[model samples]
Target: MFETVLKCTKCGKEYSLASGIYKCEKCGAPLDVQYDYDSIRDLIEDNDSWFREPPRVWKYWMFYPVSNLRKIVSLNEGGTRLYRMKNLEKKLGFGKLYVKNEGENPTGAFKDRGSSVEITKALEFHAKKVVVASTGNMAASVSAYGSKAGLEVTIVVPEGTPIGKLVQAVVYGAKIKIHGSTYDESLAESERMAREEGYYLTGNYHYRVEGQKSTGFEIFDQLRFDSPDWIVVPIGAGTHLRAIWKAAKEFYELGLIEKLPKIAGAQIEGYDAIVRAWKERKPITPIKEKKPTVASAIAVKAPVDGENVIKAIDESEGYLGAVTNEETMEAGMMLGKEGLFVEPSSATALALAKTMREEGIIDKDESVVIVATGHGLKDIKTWESFIKL
Candidate 1:
C-alpha cells in the first residue's frame, strides 16, 4: 500500500493519514492527499506492471489515496482514449491536437473519476449516506457510485438543473432535493444539510480530487510519459484543473515525468470569475449574478474553489479565457462532426483553444490537448434545440 498524508493546499499544514478532516481547520482551505513517492517508486521499480491487465483508472491504484483496495467503489472509470485530431490539427495549424474524451466514463461524464474515489472513502468512513450539491454532472456521478456502493445518496441541485442529469440521479436511487434559484444557493443548502445531519459531503472532498488525478496520469501514460505542451479544460468548480495540477507535481516528484504542461481553463462569458480575475490581475471574486447558458453543466455563479483555480493557472504559466454561448455551441457542433458528441461545456476547451490560437497566445509548434469532460447525451435537450436533427 502507498503511504499517504493530508496537506492543506493554502497553509501547507500536513496531517497524518488517520485524520478524518476534509478542510483545514486553521485556515479553512481545502486539504490534499500527500503520498510517499519514494515508497511508490520502490514498488514500481521502473516496471509497467500496471499496464498488464485492466484498462481502468484503478490500474494506477498505487497513486490513488485509498489505503484499502477492497473498499474501492469503481465502475471501471478512466482509461479514456486520447483521439488525435488530424483535421483540427491541420486546420488550426497547431503542431498536434488531441481530444481527451472523458464522455466514455460510466455516467457519461468525467465526474465519475472523482465520484468513484469519493464514494469509496465514504464507505471507509462508515458514512450511512453521502451528500453532494451539484449543477448536473457531479450529482449524477456521485449518485450512481454511491448507489452501487450500497450507500444512501442525497443530491441537492437548483431547480433549473438539466432534466437528463436529474433523471440519472433519480434512476440511480438517490434522494434529490431541488432548492434555491441558482447552483451556489443549492450548494450552500447542501453543505448546511450535511453539517446538520452528519452526512459525508463528497463534493470538493480531497479524495475526490485524488480520484481526478488519475486523468492526468492516464494522459501522461498515453503520451508515453511525456508531458504535453498544454492541456485545456473547461472550469466550473475548478476541481479538475486543480487535480491535474496536483498530479503533475506528484509525478515530477516521483521522477515519472520530466516536465509539466501548462494548464488553460475556459469558462462561459457571464460565469467567468476565474477568467475575469486573470484578466484584471486581481484575486478571484465569486460571480454574484447567474446567467443563462446553453452549457448548464458549467453555469456555476460562485465556484467554491475559485482561489485555487487562479493559483493553478498562474503556476502553470497559463491564461484563462471565456467563450460566448454561441461559440460554445458552434464548437460542440464542430466536434460532433468528428464523431465526438460532447456537451457545450466540454466543447469550451475547443472554443478556448480556437480563441487562443486566433489571438496568437498559443504557438503553432505546441502540442495541445483538450479535455472533453462530458457526453452530449446528458444535454440532449440543449443540443436538440439548436441542431437540426
Candidate 2:
C-alpha cells in the first residue's frame, strides 16, 4: 500500500510497482525499488513493536516492494540470529566482531529472503512457473517457494553443483536441468530461458533485491538501529551487497539511521568478477566470465551488477578482498569451532576479514559485521577435510 514503485538507479525514471520491469533501457542500468518514506516512517516509528508482530522478514513489509501480503510465499525465513563472536573475536584480536548467520532460514540459506519476494512477485505477474540457474542454494530456494505457491520450478545447475544443493532442489520438486561445466554456463542458460519463455527472473529482480535488502534492515534492527563501522559481505551475483548498501542508504535517507556503513565484499580468488572491476582502475566493465571456486555458491564468473558492487564499496569507503578456497574452508571450520555453522561462501567474507586483519589492512578496534550468506549444510562436501574423518 505504501509502495513508491521502481526507479532506475541511473536515470531516475520511475515505474509502477506492478510494472514488472526490472532494468532501465533508457540508461542501460539496473533499477531499484523505492518507497514512500513518509509512510515507512509512520509504520516503523516504533520498530520494536513491529518486531513483536512477526518472527519473519515480512515484518518489514511496509518498507519493501511487495504489494499484496497474501501473495507472499515464505519458508519462515529472514529472522536469522546475529551472533556475537566471543572467543573468535578474542582469537582474532578484534574488539567487536559479529556475524549475521543467514543459514538458519527456512530453506537453510539466505536465498530464501530473495526467493520469498521473487515468488510473490511472480504470482503478482500471474506466472505459472519460476525458473533460475543456481550454483546450488538459489535453485533450492526457488523450488521451495514455487512449491508453496503451487507453481512449477525449473532449475539449472552446473555439472558439479554440490550434492546437498542438488538434493535440496530436487526434494522441493523442481525440474532440475544440469548444464555446462560451470555455474556461469547454467546462469546464462537460465537467463535465456526466462527471456525466451514467460517465466519470471527471480535472482536479479528489483523486488527480489528489495526483499533481500531487508537483511540489512534487520541487521540494523538487531543492533538497535546502530550502523556498524564496517560490513563484509560475500559477493556472488552482487545482489546481496547491492541490496544491503541500498537499504542502508534508504535508512539514512528516511532518518531512521545516521550514516551508511562501509560495505566490503569478499570473493573467492578463482571466480572474482567484482574484484577484477575494482582492480581495473577504469570505468566499471560489463560483468562477464567462467565461474570457478571451491566455495561453489559464490562462484560466479560474471555478476549482472558489477558496477553497483564496486560503487557500493567506493561510496561506503571500503575495499575488495579475495580469499583462496583453502582459506575459505578454514574460515568455515573456524566458524564451526566458534559454534556458528555457515557455508564456505559465507566463510569467504570472514576469511577475508581475517586475512585483512593479519595483513594490517584492517584495524582491530573497528566495529565490524561479517555477512555469513549461507548455512554450512548447503556445502557439506567441503566439511570433511576440516572436521576430520
Candidate 3:
C-alpha cells in the first residue's frame, strides 16, 4: 500500500490516515486523501499488465485510498460505456460528442462507485453500522454495499424521493428514516446520528470522492489516455465534478495525460447554488426555499462540496450553468432517441452542454463528453408523468 495522508481542503492542516478523520479538526472543512504519487508513478511505469484486467472499479485499485484488497466490497462497478453520439454530434454540429453512461453500474446508478469504496473503508475502520443521507441514488447504493459487507445499514432520505430508488434500499434491508423535507435536513440528521450512535457516516465526503474519481480514470482509459476538450458533469453535492478534476490532475502529474480537459458543471434551475456562485465569483450562499423540479436526484439546496467545485471550474477554465426542468426533459428525450435512457438529473449535463455550445462557451469543433450519471429507470414516475406513456 502506498503512503497516504489526509489534508484539509480549506486549511493546510494534515492528519495521518490512521486518524480516521473525515474533516479537519482545525477548520471544520473536508479533508482530501493524498497518496504517495511517486511510488504510484513507478508502479504504473514498471507494470502495465493491470491495464489489461477487466475494466471495473477494482481495476484501478491502486488509485484508491483503501489498502486491503480483500476488504473491498464491490459490485463490479465502473467501466461504463463511453458511447460516441454520432447522430447527436451531427445534429448539434459538434466535432465529436460522447456520453459516459454511468447507468451501467450494478445498482443502475453511478453512486455504486462511491459505495464500493465507502463500504470498504467502513470495514477497515471496524465499523459495524453505516448511515447515509440521500435524495435517492446514494441511499440505494450504500444500502446494497452495506448489506454485502454484512453491516447494518440506515438510510435517511428527504420527503418525495423517487419510489424506485427507495424500493431498492428497502430490498437491500436498510432501515429507512424519512426525516425532513429537503436533502440538507436529512444530511444533518444523518451526521447527528453518526456522531451520537457510532454509525459510520457515508456520503459525499473525501473517501467517496476518492472512489468517484474512477469515472475520470475510465474516461481517459477508454479514450486511450487522451483528454477531451470539455467534460460536462451534473452537480448535486458537487462531488463528482471535483473528483473528475482531481483525477485529471493526478493523471497529468503522473505523466499519463498531456493536458487536462475543461470541466463544465450542470445544475437544475432551482438547485443551482454552485452555478450562481460561479457566475457571481463569490462563496456559495445556501438556498433557503427548495423549488420542485423534475431532477430530484440533483435537487440539493446546499451543496456540500460547492466551494471546491467552483475552484475546480475556475482552475480548469470551465463553465457552470443551470437549465430549466423543461430543458432537462427535452435533453432526456434526445438521449432516449439515441437509445440512452437517463434520469432527468443526468440529462442536465446534456442540457448544459447544449447551452454552452450555443453560447460559444464550448466550441463546435471541440470534442465533448457529457456524463450521464444515472438510468431513467431510477426515476420512472418522473418519466411517466412527462412522456404521457
Candidate 4:
C-alpha cells in the first residue's frame, strides 16, 4: 500500500486515504497527497542508477502518490526526450537551452502523464466512468488511456479545437461533447456532467496532480541537478503550471535542490486569464467564448485553476508573458527549422523567451527550459499557411 497521505493546502486538514473523492471537505480546495520522505532521500539519492531501470514516469513511482503499480494503467507515458539546443541557444542568446519534448507521449502530448494516473485512480475506485474537459491535448490523452483501461470515457472539448485532435477523440470511441467557443466553455459543460454522473474529473482529481508531478521528477533526473534556471510552460487551465511548481517545491523541501527555478507562464494574448490575474492582483473575470488563435490548444477563456496558478507565479516571483498569434506562429516555425515540430501553443514559450530577451528580463547566461506540450501534427491542417517549405 502507498503511504497514502492526504493534506489540505487551504485548511490544514487531513482526509482519509482513497476517499474515492478528491476535494477537501472543510475548505473545498483540492487536496494534495503527502508521502513519507523518511525513506525517499536514501532511496532517490542514487537517482541515475535508479532511474535507468524504468524509462517512463512510473520510474519515480515511490515519489508519486499512486500505491499499487500493478493496478496502474499506462501507455508508457512520460520520460520524454530532453534536447539540448546549441542552435536554439545561439538564436535566443541563452547560455544553454533545453527542450522537454512531450510530443512523444502515447497521445502525442504531455497530458498523457496525468491521464495515466487518472485512469489508475479510476480503476482503483471502480469508478463509473472517466471524464475530462480539455481543449485538444488533454481530451485526446484521456480518451486514449481511458480506452486502454476499459473504462467508459467521455471527453469534453471546445468545438474549435484542432481537427486532428477532434478526430482522434471521435475515432477513439469516447463520448464527446463539443461546446464552448473555447476550452473553458467546454470545461463548464463538463462540470455539469461530472456533478450529475459522478464521473472522475481529471482536472479536479488528486491522482491526476500526483501523476503530472512526474514531469518535474523526470526533468530533475534529466538535468542531473535539482532544477533549471527557468522553466517555460504554456498554460491553458494552469494545472500543469501548478504541478510543476508543486513538484519543484517538494524537491526543494526534501533537500533535492538548493533553489527552485522560476516557472514562466506563457499565454496567447487573447486567452491570457492568468496573465491578467497576475498583473491586476485579483481573480480573473470569466470569459466564456474566446476568439480563435493558431495557439488553439492553450486558448481557454477561463482556466479553472486561476487562483492557485497566480499564487504559484506570485510566490515564486515568476513572471508571465503573452505571445501573439503572429508571434506564436513565427516561433513554431522557428522550432520547426531547428528540427522541432511542436504545436503552436508550445511555441508560445520560445516566443516569450525571445520577447524577454529583448527586454533583458532573463539573463542570457542562465539555462532555460521550454516545455513543448504537444505534437505539431494535431494542428497540421493549419501548418500549410506557415510552413516555409
Candidate 5:
C-alpha cells in the first residue's frame, strides 16, 4: 500500500499505480514501482515484529507493491542460506568468502523469488492466464506458481533449453511452446502473445525485480544488517544484479545498513554483452549469433536490463566480467567440493570472483558473497557431459 507510482527508469515519466502499465509509454523503457519511503521508514520504526517473522518474501511485504497479503501466491520462496565457504576461503587465499545459495528455493532456482511476486500480481489483476519466455529457470518457476494460483500458464522456451528445466514446467501442467533457437526469439513470441492474447506477461519486469530484491535483503539480514564488501551475481537479463543494488540502496537510505556493497556481475563469455558494454563504456549491443555453452540459463544474447545493470554497477563502483566454459566448470567443481552443487551459470559468479581476486581488482581481505543462482540438477544434461559420474 505504500507504493505511490510507477516511474520510468529512462524518461522520468510517472503513472498511477492503477494504470496497469509495466513500461514507459513515452520512452519505451522499463518502469519501476516507486514507494513512499518516509511512510515505510515510519512503519518499520514503529513495528519491530516483522523482523522476528520467518525470513521469506512475504516477510518484506512492506517493500513490495502488493495490496493484499492474504492473496499472495507463494511457494515459501526466499530466505535462502548464506553459507561461509571457509574451505574455499583458505584454498583461494581470500580473507572472507560466502555463497548466498539461491539454489535452495522452491523449484530449485532463484527465479522462484520473482515468480512469487509476478503470480500474485497476476491474480490481483484478475488474470486467468500468464505467459513467460525462458531459457530454463523462469519457465519452471512461473509454471509452478501459476499452477498453485489456478491460472493457466503458457511457457515459451528456446530450442536447446535444458530438458531437466522443461520437465519441471511440464510436470507443473504448463502448456509448452518451443519458439525459436535463441532466448531473445522466444521472448519476442511471448511478448507478442501478451499483446495479442491478453495474457499476463511475466519475466524480468518491475514486479519481478521487486521480488528478486529479497535476495539482497536476506543477505543483509543474515549478516545482521551489515553490508558485505562485494556481492557477486551472474547476469542473464541483468535483472538480478540491478535488483540487489536497488535493495542495498533502499536499506542504506532507510538507515538499516551503513554502507553499500559493490555489485559484481558475471556472464558466460559469448553472452557477455553487459560486461563488454561496461568495459568499453558503450551502450549494450545484442550478440547477433548464438554460441553453444553449458550455462544455458544465463546465455542471454540481448540482456533486457543491460542499461540499468550498468548504471547499478557504476553507482556501486563494481566489476563485471565473463569467464570461459572451462573456467565455469572448474568453478562448479570448486563449489561442489564446498558441499554446494550449482549450475554453470551460478558457478560463473565464483569464476569471476576468483579472476578478480587474482587480478587484484578485488582485494584479498574484503568480505565477498557470491550469489549462486541455480541448482546444478536444473541442468543435469549439461552436468552429465562435463561432470562424469
Candidate 6:
C-alpha cells in the first residue's frame, strides 16, 4: 500500500491521508495526492512482472492511495484505445499524431475514471449520500457509479446540459437539481449542499485527480512506456491537466520515463479562463457571463483548480489555447471523417493541435498525442449539423 498524503499544490501543506478534505485549509487551493515514491519504486522492483498485466489503470494499483482494494468501485474506466492517426498526420503534416479516445469508457466520457475512484473513496468514508456538479459528463459518471454502490446520488447541472449526458444521469436514478445558467453556479450550489446537507461531495477532489491520472498511465503504456513530445487535452475544471502532469512526474521519479511530456490544454473560445490567466501571467478571474458554444462539456465559467492548471502548464513547458466554435465543429467533423466521432469539447484537442502546427508552435518532427475526452454520442444533437453536410 502507498503512504499517501493530501498536499496543497500552492502552499505545500500536507494533511493526513484520512483527513477527507478536498482543499487546503490554509490557502483554499486544490490538494494533490502525494505518495511515498521510494516505497512505490521498491514495490515495483519487487513485483516487476505483475506490472505488465492488462486492465490498464488497475495495473497501477500500487500508485493509487486507497488502502483497501475492497473499497474500490470500478467500472473498468481506464484502458481506452490509443489510435495512431497516420492519415491525420499526413493531412495535417504533423509528426506522429495520435488520439487517446477516452470515449470508450462505460459512461462514454473520461469523467468515469475520476468518478469511479471518488465514489469508492466516499464508500470507504462510510458516506450514505454523494453529490456532484457537472456540465453533464461528471454528473452521469457519478450517478452511474453511485447507483451501482447503492448510495443516494444527487446531481446539480446547469440549465443547458447536453440531452444525452443528462439522460444518462436521469436513467441512473440520481435526483437532479437544476441550478443557475452556468456550470460554476451549479458547483456553488453543490458546495453549499455539501456543507449544509452533509452530502459527500466527490467532484474536484484530490482522489478524483488521482483516478484521472490513469489516462496518463494508459497513454504511457500504449506508447510502449515512452514519452511523447506533447499531450493535448481539453480543459474544463482543469483537474485532468494537472492529473496528467502528476502521473508523468510519478513515472519520472520511478525511473519509468526519462522526462515529462508537454501538457497542452485546449478550450473553446468562450470558456478559456485558464488560457486567459496563462496569457496574462496572473491569477484566474472567473468569467461572469459565459457565451454560448457547441462545446458544452468544457464550457466552465470558472475553473476551481485554475492555479494548479497554470502551474502544470508552466512546469511542463506547455501552452493553453482556445478555438472558435466553428473550428471546434470543424475538428469534430474531421474526426468523424476518420470514423472517430467525439464531442465538440474533445475535438478542441485536435483544433489546438492544428492551430499549433500551422502557427509553427508545434514542430513537425515532434510526436503528439491528442486526448479525445468524450464521445460524440454524448452530444448527438450537435452531430446533426455535421450530418446535414
TM-score of each: 0.95, 0.91, 0.97, 0.90, 0.97, 0.96
Q: How far off is model 2, as Cα RMSD?
A: 2.5
Q: Over 4 Å off in model 5, which ranges?
A: 158-164
At residue 338, give the lDDT of candidate 6: 83
The residue-by-residue lDDT of candidate 3 on 152-256, one tens digit each, is: 999998887666668889999899888898777888999988889999999989999989999999898888889999999999989999999999999999988
Candidate 4 clash figure, as a count? 0
Q: How many angstroms is residue 146 displaced in model 4 relative to the true structure, after the best TM-score fit? A: 0.9
Clashing pairs in 1: none
What are the RMSDs of all candidates, in order? 1.8, 2.5, 1.4, 2.6, 1.4, 1.6
Task: Report the lDDT tens digits of candidate 1 across residue range 1-389.
Answer: 57567888889998977777778889988888877788888777767765454446887788787769987899989999999998888887888999999999999999999888888888878898988887578888999999999988989877766666688889988998889977667877877877788888888778888889888888888887788989999998888989988888887777778998999999988999888888898877777766788887887776666778888888999878999999999999889878899988999999999889889888899999999999989888888888775
Candidate 5 per-residue lDDT, tens place, 141-190, comes to 99999999999999998787666667888999899889998777888899
Candidate 6 deviant stretches above 4 angstroms: 158-165, 179-182, 386-389
Candidates 2 and 5, the one with greater TM-score: 5
Better of 3 and 4 by TM-score: 3
Quote model 6's TM-score. 0.96
Runs of candidate 3 exceeding 4 Å displacement? 158-165
**Candidate 4 local lDDT, 12-59, one digit each (tens):** 688777665557788777777887776777677757587456447888
| Residue 167 lDDT (model 4) | 76
Over 252-361, each residue of candidate 6 has an lDDT whose tens digit, in order, gives 88888887899899989878888988998877888777588888788887787788888898899998999999998998888878889898889999999999999988
